[model samples]
Target chain A: MSERAKTPLIELHGLTKTYGAGDAAFQALKGIDLTIQQGEFVAIMGPSGSGKSTLMNVLGCLDAPTTGSYRYQGIAVGSLDTDQRSLLRRYALGFVFQGFNLLARTSSLENVELPLLYRGDSRKERHRKAVAALTSVGLATKLDSRPSELSGGQQQRVAIARAIVTEPGTLFADEPTGNLDSVTTRDIMELLTRLNQDRGITVLMVTHDDHVAATARRTVLIKDGLIESDLVRT
Target chain B: MIWNAFSIALREIGRNLTRAFLTVLGIFIGVAAIITMVTLGQGATLAVKAQISNLGNNLLTLRPGTGFGSRAASAGVPSFTQKDAETIGEQISGIAAVAPVRTASQSTIYLDNARACAVTGTTPVYFGINKWRLAEGRFFNDADLRSGAAVCVIGDTVRKELFGGEDPVGARIRIGRASCEVIGLLAAKGQAGMGDQDDTIIMPLSTLRRRLIGKTSSHDINQISISAQDGMDSNALINDITSLMRQRRGLGDNQDDNFNIFDTRQIAETLGATTQLMTMLLAAVAAVSLLVGGIGIMNIMLVSVTERTREIGIRLAIGATAREVLLQFLVEAVTLSGVGGILGIVLAFGLCAGLAHLIQVPFNFNLRINLIAFHFAAAVGVVFGYTPARRAARLDPIDALRHE
Candidate 1:
């Protein structure tokens, strides 16, 4: 417990998010408290309408909580403007989605180099780093392939390569393998487990599938926008 | 961030090549039209002005009576006879020379080869007044006019037309029912508004008077060409001529002068003003095309933003500021317009050359106009490209990522 006080990478307290205004207002998040420490692989699981997606948005820094505060690296992230939030997302969080979100009309190398591009890397440097990132995701031969040219599983791999290319502080993946076949899903889960154990990269994934959630070292269950149970899998 | 956005823009445009080209076409036509119209219009004006100035600074042309447009065929106004020419020569101060002219049209032949040609009857001074230089042989002298000799001087065009490349000097050519000898050949002066100077056959004034018209009149002198001495006041010279004409015509103190005296400078200014107005009108019409081009850019940009929503969301998630996103698409738009503007300049020159040939005006492809229009189109692209780029930049990543 004394070690838990050393400073978690992400700490949120009584966070609440609402949409619209007046009588049409709908609360998407309600009184949520969560902490994610460095080098911790955690999975969030919940049924539909449980506010798991909304919580993921706040956790990923893609949106701001209408109530309470979020501290990133001990700095209050809620105080930052849109630009800094974007910078935090780029430098601190690597995101992988079920849809992959790969840019069309672009190659795998360019996709992986995107985050580094915001870091002011030269074209030559961007190319070298993007190549290295693709290799890490077992896409060494598919650097020039556009998203449409690759299979679904391969495209998802390229997307994962893009997410982890920047070596971000935390990786936030929401249903990263939901769109993959059973074989591809197993391969992706193996990749995530290896990244967590070998690379020691912290991961926060949201998934409803028990098999997918079982790959993470810890799992947190949310019900009605509240954490109903937390468990560690050995 | 800027570079990231730029690549996104470049790739998007590359993906939609057809849309990109269509967007810049508007600017292309606008710029090209502007350049072509202005160049040809200004070139023609310059050519005319240069030719007129080449006629010399000391020259003046006088036409008889109040009628300005009609003069050559029949003297509708009172004729300035030998007596009036002598009087103006003697009384007008700072005057150089006075020559009375009569011109009639006839298609006569020497060797059965007949072509319609102008027969000009004037004194030997007509050669000097009109700055006609002799290419071969001598022009008519006082002896030719005094003797009413049937001798003539042929312009270069008529020399080529009737004489076919032959030296027509010393050759006999029929003029107005009387065969005359071609004593001299005038130098080639190309085409002018009055007609081809080289095509006219100039003869002794006495011969044209007796042979062509065969009638005498005191009220039918077509024109008077005057010249003031160098370093002399043209205004004072005009006043002297005006007063002399008034005295001779027997006008009262309150009566308006029957004849008109015009300044070449005034004609030049009026001509320039008309040309300038034409240039402005043409340029304004062409500018409308440029606006249409900007709309094209806006249209393509809107499509691009819609198509690349996911890309924009990804960039935003990866630390791209709105400014980066904006600049990326904006630069793409500018590049399209800039390339189109360059191509437009080349096309403008081509159109100018073609039109100049059609209208017989000197073609001048000016670089200054091209550069200005190039920059103008580029600016249009940037300004028009901003709204769509800004909108794309400000889109919510959460929403965009979720979009199908």
Candidate 2:
């Protein structure tokens, strides 16, 4: 195996998360141990309230695990401060939500330029990079269109462009096509697959749909706050 | 980073233009009120000083009164004589001029026009003591005073009311029961003290005592106006006059002088101080509105933060640090108040100018007060904006994202 294949991009050991305390305490994640390799497309599948969203939040560095260790590229993520985690998210991670979170009344070009703005990129560079990213997603002609003016599929495409604008190493999509129709869902999944294969960007998506899970090379099924099955497509 | 924050703030404020304007209105009114009060107050104080200066420098007035406030009510005290004024002018070394004044109110008539005005009887030295100038013809001379000439100098108000556009210098006007020729016109001096100085008529003390009052004796005078020579110590001159008056009145050392001596310059200073105190109080009251304006800003900002919780979450997810979010909201607050400050200044300038013109006072541009008010408004923004900004910065990304 090559060195890139030998090293995992994300490693979670005995990770657990709980909410509230003293009689109202409830465990959302019960000691999950998962690993995702570089340049791999992985899908996390689970039913409603099976802790898949909580796990996705943890992997995206949006939340800290209550117990155990989470490492991104061999560095302990839980030990990092909020600012450091923010930097990590800025440089190494991207997120796409189910609701397609784009700023209202802003052009798609400016929306896509947000991540680059946080990176302290010059305005010209941000514009150039944002255009290139939008073009790669076949949205070069819709740069000036606002999310409210666009369709559901188009808004999601803009969200994806925003996510990948900074060229982070990994993309985390939590039910990215949840709000789309079946035809648009297939289109979005195809785009994710193309990004994974052509750009070699690692993609970790959480979905309950088997059809969405089928697009990934590896699948991990979560039940009762723990991994019940792990499968390889081949 | 500053530019980035500023742009975001600009965009957010622009997006909600109406709400933003309404939110800043409180600051606008507060700043305008403070600046208007202070500027107009300063103008009023300056106007009063200028009018008092028209009474001339190093001037002392001896009135027949022993009480505080107005010296017009001298019923209990004995009036000074013309001899007393002449004695001071001759015996006092630093005396520049001493004019004995005997005042009486009369309705002067000219043709069919009649107006109530003050008729002041004094010598030619009264013009020099008051530094009054003639607008037309010439002032009464010693010949006029000695001969008891029936001549008078009409003020601007009297000239306007009685003569209309016609020149009153060579015309005749009735003073009380005596018909006097208008020999000269006193230049306009506007208003002073409790009445208009330009509305009075000045005449020779001998002419007024004989013709108007029908009094043959020249011993009775209402007051004495004394002017000290240039470079003379006014206090020493006052001391000299006080002792001379006491001796003339035969008052013992233990007895009161039975008279009043006052400085017109000190009166102007006192008026200035009173107006200054009032301006400060008005400004302080207006500053409370600024504090209330700050509270309004805080209230609106808190609502804005809550309304944009999801937006904050989105920003956090896009790698913006909590400090960045904090800075963004703080910049927004400062921008709101800063713009309001500028607008208030413009409004105040217009309002104060209009008010000063209406009240016949000069418009004073006080840059120090304007800048202080502007910066203070901005500071209010920061202080009141802190809590909401901190609340925004401390929000958990997950919970914020989940917010409806």
Candidate 3:
């Protein structure tokens, strides 16, 4: 088990993504090679029009790289079909959007249970796990409140509960605190950091703020569809 | 997976109930219209059959013309005499009874009350041939016909109009310039396809010709009604009557007979076929509206798919398969139409019962048609829902998530 844990959780070799065809073709990612280990909290930072978002999509298995290979836990993701990739995401991946993306008019508990529903969990099991997830996010009393009724910070907590309820090994957050205030952003960051430390769940986050990136142990920055630098905090 | 999709669909529909109701309005109207039209049409067909059967069993009528609605054929045709009726009864093998008839419209008066009534002149056999029964008094006897007595039997309608509640039997009523004694009252037959059957008065043939019509000619009889024996085929009886009538009229082998014989059973079959054809035509038209309703479902489902693109993105990102997404939308569409079909069935029953009462036809509750309509509505949902569901399922998650 210790040797298996030493192997990289994610590995990409010469990955590239191109949109459209012929003269109108535009390249989003150009020849990127990267590896992420298990239980790593990494931040991806880039300016507008950089390849950071595309890299995040490819790494999350939401989009396939046009040229080259991507392996998640040594399983070749590039060769898998759309449904197979979906299965991979179902068992191993979770996502949090900048908009919270919680279903409107649904209670927070139901929102957290959405991923488990797709996993075919029983009603009792889903309810128990959803309650535990919400409680871990300090939202034990807001179980029945809908997204519209909750504050922005509370909505993000509900989204985080939904992400973790599936017990996925990796969580991809695309600007999860972009819509929240400074104090609420600090609260969400602390919650994410605590999850990484306690549960050993790897987190890949994309952010424009340096202060947000400072919360992670490692940072990778992109410019003009290419990686510019990779830095490690001691 | 399917059960989950169904619950998700139900939740989505419950979120916007007004929109859901409006979306299914077309299907509701279509189903209701189809059921109402078919139910009423079947009721009318049954009513027609009932009324025709009421005319008589195994009855035939011979008139001095090629057929009805042909005045030109009968223009120079000589009318039949009482001897012709006797020949048919004596020669035909399946004969039950035969009666010679002559009729005229005359102004009848009793005291100060006066009204125009059909005055028919025939023997007592005419009542038995037409299946008319007496409500009061007696029919004409052979002695009354032989002596040309001025006695009459009144129908229910004439008794109601001219006699009010008073009994017309044993009373004298003036017919044209002659006074006739009423001896019997015919029972009510209500309304038939031809018209009111209980609005005429009957007298002996000799009395109508000698006293009322003042026509001394014995060959003035215009109609001969013949009834066949029970369980007898009418076509053979008509052929026998035709041969006998031709032999008596002294017609050549190739010459057409100057008269027409009508089998009542054939008339009933023709009338029944016509009504059934009309019913099918109305039902087909109602089915077209049901198709249009399916198109309405497709249109609304397409709109829903487009509006919920972001929701689809979220589900996909959270590990829902494209098949699951497709199933979700498809279930929603079917649920909407299924509910509409049920509501339409309820509405159709109320409307059909009310309309049947107003038009005086029986209300028929046909379960087979209701079930067929409900199943068809659900099928429409599947056929129209596939395109929109496929569209939603095939959406790119990255692009969908960015959609406004």
Candidate 4:
């Protein structure tokens, strides 16, 4: 386990992202070099226009870097084609958005089972895993409730269940608690910390609030497309 | 994977039932209209064939002049004689029977009733040629023709009008100035293309010319009906008859024959072709509606893709491939139109049956056309659904997620 922890799960070197072309171009990430180990809970923090979301997008394999290289478990992500990247994300990565992003008019159970559905799991297997995931998030009783019927915090919990339903190695949360009240944010933070410690699932989150950032074991602060400081609590 | 996509599509459609229903309404109307038109067209064609075949099997009527009308019956044209009919009967190889006909509308009085009826002068062979059956009593015998006896066979309508439910057989009725005894009651032949066949009286040609008309010198006849032997081609017989009449009439080369020969089979075929053309035309119009329905589907699918952008983004983020997303939307469109197609088929059946009964045509349920219509509707779904689905699939997850 110590030897496995020594090998980094994600490694980024001189990564940069630019939007648009020619004179219309605006660089979102000037350069980003970061390494994260397995089973770590890290928070990425930045003010508006600091490119933290861009970094999270690149880390989540949703966007490609314009320059430099990113390696997930020593596999060069820049060399992967769109479909290959999709496959990598399908098997190794999961996501939770600030908006919850659960399909509208769908029940909580079906929303939670969506990732497993994409994984091509059988109906019975999807139901079993989704129920287990929802139960872990304290939403077992709200299985048939739609997002409209659920509170914002409950919807976020459903989103979290969906992310972990496929048992992916890493979870990327972009402002997961941004839409929740402070009390519900604490409850969600507790759930994330428990999942990180108990299941050993690596959780990387982006937040502007220092209070939300305090829940993570490590914090990386970005300003003007560059990491200003990365601090470890322990 | 396909099943999963289909279920997802069905669920999405089920979420907004009214919108989905409105979207597919065009498809429903188009399919139903096409099917009803085709079915009715087939029934009309069948009715035409049945009506024409009622005239007689392999029957050909040779009438005076080029065609039927005032111009054809002008004074310059000469009518056929009984000798012409005899010569054709002897000369034509495939001829089964021939009957010379002379018709005149005359007022006949029986008891206290008087009715204007068609007085037909023909022979015993006319009964066989026209497939006429006797409801009661016997037709004129050879002796009756030889003696020029005033005995007639009354059609069903004539019997009912002149006799009023009383059997007219063996009853004497005065036609023109001569009294004739009704020998046979002809069975009802109903309506044919020309008109009602059951409103005439038939007698021997010799009896009508000698006794009723009071003319023994002129042997002019209005028409000659010829029946070909079974399995004989009417076209060949018509060609032969045309040549014979031309030669007998002594027309010079390059002179068009003044007489017209009407073949019942040819009439049936021409009428059938005309009805089929009409069917095709109506079906083509209905097909345009189907095309419009496809366009409607495309329009709605585009809107649906736009409305569900964030949903697509969520699926993409959760590890759905582009192809999977495309399949989901494609299946939704197909399901929408397919359901519409099924509903259209059901509506078409009801409409076809109801209209057929109302219009007095047969209700023809065509399985092949129904199948083709359904497949075409589904195909329309695929064709129209492709663009919107591709648009959904190609969307950038970040941009789509950001969309409100």
Candidate 5:
């Protein structure tokens, strides 16, 4: 409760998202109010058609809400243009998609350096930071290996390295282990948990699996287009 | 930032090297065609100008003909006499040298074998005006012109035909009832557009008038060759000679001069202008292919943008500005076409050299045209690449990520 007095990392007020127009319009989110503090591990869980993905997109700055105010570190995100939003995403945010979207035919080191490259980092800085990130993920020997040459778990690890290469304030993982086998999923979940606890990085993961949600310190459940329950674990 | 984009673009192109090369093939052919045509056309023009200039330096031929394209052999026009030539030589202000000439065919020559050949009769001034060089022995002096000596200078072709690699100097050959000594041999001048200038024999004008034509009444001559001094206005000299001939022939104003004055420089200029026109026409036609090649680049770039939609989405999601993405793809397009331009230049030079050799023309490399073609190809890459790059930049990241 004391966390509410401090400035939050992200805030959404009455956030609403809609698709199409007129009679064909569908509202994906309605009157959503959410807040995330620094160094918090939160999991958003929902069934299909429950608008959880839409909420994640807005939070990640990947999409703009139809009628809402989004603030990142107290700056209004909804007022920003596309390029401005991209700049925010480049500097302050990191995303891990379900499909480990590493550029094909590119070395893992190059994939990890992508975010820093957009920030106009020097080549030497980019290489140093990317190597450190890969080393943190225990993939130092696979720097030159391309995504095609790596296993599914290794590819996801490279994606994680890329996400953290910029030392982003927040990591948004949408079904990061959705394509992995049970063993690989467990290994990835353990890695995510270690990153959140050791580095104190704010992690917001969207998953339907209750077990995956259990690893997060807080669980948010959504039903229909609204948050049904919010629970904090000890 | 630009270096980053450039490196990315180079890597992407390297990833699909074969496709990139194939895509630029049209541009390659287009540039090569334009350069090859222009280079060869210029070479041919230069060759023609060289041949025309080789006919004579500052020379003009006065023949018995009316209007342009009239043959000197055509009847009805009166022939000029030695007295007329002497009058022009003494009266014209810029006349450097003048020679009255008489030509005759069917001269029987015997030098181990006899062959009928065309023989030209002229004074020592003919050698000076025409700039004919002696390969061996000495030319006819003033003594030969005054005494009407039966001495002749054999051309390269006549020497080859009759002498057969042997020195024909001091050898005696018979022309009709006259026996002439071969005092000199003229150097080879190769073939000219008009005819082979090196296939005839040269003798004294007086000797031919007396021995060949048997003109006992007057010193009748076929034509007169005149040379103007360097830096002199030949047109004024030509006008002066025209009025002189008209007055001598007793013709009134507007009677149409019966004699044709052919200036070698003027003929060269006219021929040069015609060849220049031909070169322009060829270049224009070849430029059409460059346009087609530009269209080809546009088509391939569009297809590439569509094919790389997922890649674009990834870039966008990773915080790459739309401008950066656009620049990356544009750089790739430019690299492809720029390489094509280089390859085209190489091919054009090789092809131009081979063709020029085959056709016996000079191979003139036009650096300006090559640079223009190269830069134009790069510009084509930019113009044609803009649409696809914009399309890729404007793509919705969400939709692009969803694209297969």
Candidate 6:
């Protein structure tokens, strides 16, 4: 088969991230090579300390890889300076944490406005976009309810609104339902699936749950520091 | 961006209101203590200067033998007489007037009203030599001085203390076994080291010598005061008095003069230097409290960073520049300090007012210094609030996201 002519969204070659140094140095990621195509929703699965989270960080540009080349849309992301990397993070990446890290004492609408604020959006645009985002996450009715006032499921919905408000190129979710109950987890998964299927949003989510992995069209499993398998099952 | 950071800071402060309040309390107390203590020190310096300047500037006091602290308490000294004062005034070139003083203290009882007070004995020129004003009747004249008249001038304080403000002028007041008519009221002069100059009765030296008490020796004048003319050189006047006194005392060229001439202007430098040193010391002491306040700010910032770890992770993951994170936390710190500083200034002024009334220190209510202190407090907040904010901003998001 001809090599895919379409430019990859993320390309990581010989990627490694180490912690500490000398005899105490522990390698979290060891020579990981991965490619993600445009608009492909993927899932990463691994046991604890398998370096899946490390892989996600490199993918999200939250950190630099220890010794590797990371190309995002043909620009060497791994080589970008702090400000350039910040610029990349500003316009290209969205993040959802497992614990539903919604800012306390803030409205759902304002939570969605955070990423837009980072982009220096005008106030009117910020408000309109935030409202639109809350509508997308089915949080239009809970605009003013604080994080403490919302249930785990509703809080997760608010967090999802926050993530996509910027309309970034990629959405990275790190076990987005780890702290939620099973029913709430299912609801959040369905929401993620809708974003991937209907809106053409590229999503990479990390989860140990097989059910969570099943929602994605492709799943990659890592054991130790290297990827053991990549399965495509639509 | 600064406003946004400030809002976040305000919100964070509100999140844990108790912690914020306690943190600000440290800065507030430090600033307040500094402001109040410095104000007191400034007020004391001003009061002392005013009192000394009001005593007289052109006048010099010559005490017999070596005198250090007070006018009357120099020991082992051969006393000088009023005749010495007369000689100095007549013989010296630049001097305009001379007066010698004698003092006594006793219990005065007049018709069932009794109070203890001091009495001063001086010449008719005593009123002119020092700036003593007559509030009621006339002061002693040349005719009275030459006749050794039994007329006296009593101060407002003496009138209030002894006669209950019943117009002691022209009243006959008894001093020991002698009776003297109060010729004039000396008016209010506030306090002096002469032990409340306003609380004394003034009488002629001749009357005090003849009627109040017999002379124990040929020398009874406790202090001899010389006032230089308005257009005359005070140093030259002093030299003339020194030479004249040396010749009158029969001291040879090698012998050091036993008398000491003190100028009120000389005390200004010594007192001014002392006051400045004391003010700096007070300010330094206050600065220690500011250090404790800074520690308080650091402690609270550390706690805030710890509590907001997950939030920081979310911010970083969502494209916040590290500088932004740093700025937001820095704003929180600065906000605490700024508000604390403002409140501290208010508290300081309040403390000054209360102390001015209670402890009775001089308070001019200096507006410029007050403003400077407020701004300084804000600056302290900035200086002390920077590092912890930077530390919080620099936290790694990947690790922070996993932080419990």
TM-score of chain A of each: 0.95, 0.97, 0.98, 0.97, 0.96, 0.95
Q: For candidate 5, lDDT tens digit of each residue in B1-404?
A: 77888888888898888889887898899899989988999898888888887878899999886855734444677788889999999999988999998888855667567778888888998998998999999898889988888899989988888878788999988887889999999988878788998998999877777777677556367789999999989899999999999999888996878888989999898888898899889888878888788889889889999999988988888788899999998898888889999999999999999999998899988999999999999999999988999999999877787798
Task: Report the CAPRI category for model 4.
Answer: medium
TM-score of each: 0.91, 0.95, 0.91, 0.93, 0.94, 0.88
Q: What TM-score does candidate 2 get on C-alpha atoms?
A: 0.95
Docking level of model 2: medium
How far residue B121's Cα lies from its native spot in candidate 1, in Å, is 2.2
* lDDT (10s digit) by residue, model 2, range B345-402: 9999999999999998899799999999999999999999889999999998889988
Worst 10 residues of 6 chain A by lDDT: A1-10
Backbone clashes for every candidate come to: 12, 0, 0, 0, 0, 0
B246-308 per-residue lDDT for model 1 (tens digits): 888788999766677765544665676787789878878887788788888888888878977
Q: What lDDT is obtained when candidate 2 is compared to the true structure?
A: 0.91
> What would the per-residue lDDT of candidate 6 be over residues A1-234, giving only the tens digit for each residue?
434437788888998889889999999888888999878889999999999988888888888888989998888987886667777888988888878888887878878888887787887999999999888888889888889999999998988888888887788899998998889888999999899888878899999999888989999999899999999994
lDDT of each: 0.81, 0.91, 0.90, 0.91, 0.88, 0.82
Off by over 4 Å in 4: A1-4, B69-73, B109-114, B133-190, B250-255
lDDT string, candidate 2, A1-234, tens digits:
777667689999999999999899999999999988888899999999999999999999988889989999887998988888888898999999999989888899989998888788998999999999999888999999989999998899999999999888999999999999999999999999999999989999999888989999999999989999989889
lDDT of 6 by residue, B1-404 (tens): 78767765676788778888898888888888888878888887776676676677687888777556654445666778768888987777778788999887756655557767787888888888778888889998878877889888888877887788487877787777788898898868787544677877788887888888867776888789878878677677778888888887778999777788888756754675688679879988887887789788988788778888888877887888888888888788778887888888899888998897786668877776666666766776777778777877788877777788
Error of 3 at B178 (Å): 5.1
Model 3's chain B yields a TM-score of: 0.91
TM-score of chain B of each: 0.86, 0.93, 0.91, 0.90, 0.94, 0.88
**Candidate 1 error regions (>4 Å):** A1-5, B1-8, B51-58, B70-77, B86-97, B133-138, B141-149, B164-167, B187-199, B206-221, B228-237
- Which docking class does model 6 fall in? medium
The model with the greater lDDT, 2 or 5, is 2
Interface RMSD of 5: 1.1
Residue A159 miss distance in model 1 (angstroms): 1.4
- Number of the candidate with higher DockQ, 1 or 2: 2
Cα lDDT of model 4 by residue, A1-234, tens digit: 566666699999999999999999999999899999999999999999999999999999999999988999888998887777788888999899999999888999999888887788898999999999999999989999999999999999999999998888999999999999999999999999999999999999999999999999999999999999999998
Our model 1 lands, by Cα RMSD against the true structure, at 3.1
